[model samples]
Target: MASNGMESMQLAEDQIKILEENFNRVSKHPDESTLMLIAAESGLTEEETAKWFRLRNAQWRQAEGLPAQLGSVKD
Candidate 1:
């Protein structure tokens, strides 16, 4: 069971790497339509996509002294 769980995690990590690469290639711009379509194709709900967007934005915001708290934005 432990090995199976580890294998699953590894597979998920590999898949995420592939997806990130593909997304980077396709996501030339951070347009809403494109990201939403990609999110749908990538099996992400709008909420999940929003959360990811907020988190990514927050990381950048933190560097620039912008608000990035989870409560500061909707997920």
Candidate 2:
């Protein structure tokens, strides 16, 4: 579990690039184990990785003119 304030920390450029590459290869919402591996590689907590995915997915959906509820794990 992560501390509340930990969510505000920014990832380094390399970490963001790595994450972006993986995101492009994978679905917007990756499975838990894959997410954990990504978190480890990106030097982010699982919470931050999840949050980033959530936000990025929302942005992607908006750009595609899709509803936010579509193609989400929560659906």
Question: Per-residue lDDT of 25-54 in model 1, one digit per residue for the tens?
Answer: 764334777667756765666555544555
- Each prediction's RMSD over C-alphas, in Å, is 7.8, 5.9
* TM-score of every candidate: 0.43, 0.76
The candidate that wins on lDDT is: 2
Q: Model 2, residue 8: displacement in angstroms? A: 5.6
- Residue 48 accuracy (lDDT) in model 2: 86
Q: What is the lDDT of candidate 2?
A: 0.77
Query: Per-model C-alpha lDDT, please?
Result: 0.52, 0.77
lDDT of 2 by residue, 1-75 (tens): 334332455778898887888889976779999999999999889988888887667667768998855753572
Model 2: CA > 4 A from native = 1-9, 71-75
Query: TM-score of model 2 relative to the true fold?
Result: 0.76
Q: Judge candidate 2 at residue 10 and give its lDDT.
A: 76
